[model samples]
Target: MKKAEEVRRLERDRIKNNIVVTSTDAKGKSHEDIIHAEQIGTKIITSELENTAGKERVMKNKHKQLQERIFINNKLTWEEREKRKKMKQRMEEEKKKGRTANMGYQKITIDGKQWK
Candidate 1:
């Protein structure tokens, strides 16, 4: 009988010193009431996950925008389109040649004297 009363007293003390917190998520999902001490940790983890998900969503949206831009910008008259295509091909060729050629820096002449 004495041990039972002591256990009851301890349980009451524990409940009195602790708190239960309940939260709802963005999706209208309700979470179970958790101990107050754990609430901060739970919120931190939830925010981290939400932050990463937001970053991924933004990246996907940017990629979609880039694809749309490329398509829309390429829509032009045949002459203009062909001109742009040729310009792009020339740029690619220049890039390839630049990668293979290592032309050292040329001396810059200023006031009839070569500058370092």
Candidate 2:
């Protein structure tokens, strides 16, 4: 209970403070949240992989440097932005195909079965 409270508090602090990166371990998974926090200049704390051997790679200094870069500028260069736009189009097409292929997947109707 205390740990959960701490995690929530950290998350709230990061958002409220408008930090670039904040590390946290609310889900006990890979320290992906740290990447987010770091990107936004927030420092998060996670005990998931500190003592593990394989995590040494994830804990590398290069990752920290990248976070610093993100903190400086969240935007990509013109070329990179163009590449991202193309990537987004590709992803949208894939999502459309997936939805068309799956019969069980229903489009969300927020009002339930109400016949609009």
Candidate 3:
């Protein structure tokens, strides 16, 4: 029974250290509050974990807009597609050269028409 109590105390300490709470006061200052294990629920911990996982998934798919423009939108001509490919290659080369990578798609103008 003493060993079980000791294990529970250790687990509670771990939980207390892990649970973080952030709030904004009326003066617009941000404050971070660490929650104790006694004030936290299993649902809160699971939801926070899920929220973090969701953010990572979103970051992984940050190129969804470009993908949609290239694959889903069939309005682009072959020449425009080739230009976009070249731009992407140039961006990759710049990254390899230790330059800042440009992730924004360049606006392509062909014959007074603008295509993003």
TM-score of each: 0.25, 0.24, 0.28
- Which candidate comes out best when scored by TM-score? 3
What tens-digit string does per-residue lDDT give for candidate 1 at 34-108? 222233433221211123343344334444534333211111333434555665555456557663322112323
Worst 10 residues of 1 by lDDT: 68-77
Candidate 1: global Cα-lDDT? 0.35
- Give me the candidate number with maximum lDDT: 3
| 1-116 per-residue lDDT for model 3 (tens digits) | 99977876766444322322222211111213212222133322211222334435433553563533321111233454587898777667767887665544465333344446
TM-score rank order: 3, 1, 2
Candidate 2 ranges beyond 4 A from true positions = 1-73, 99-116
lDDT of 3: 0.40
Residue pairs clashing in model 1 are none
Worst 10 residues of 2 by lDDT: 100-109
What TM-score does prediction 1 earn?
Answer: 0.25
Better of 2 and 3 by lDDT: 3
Candidates 1 and 3, the one with greater TM-score: 3
Clashes of each: 0, 16, 0
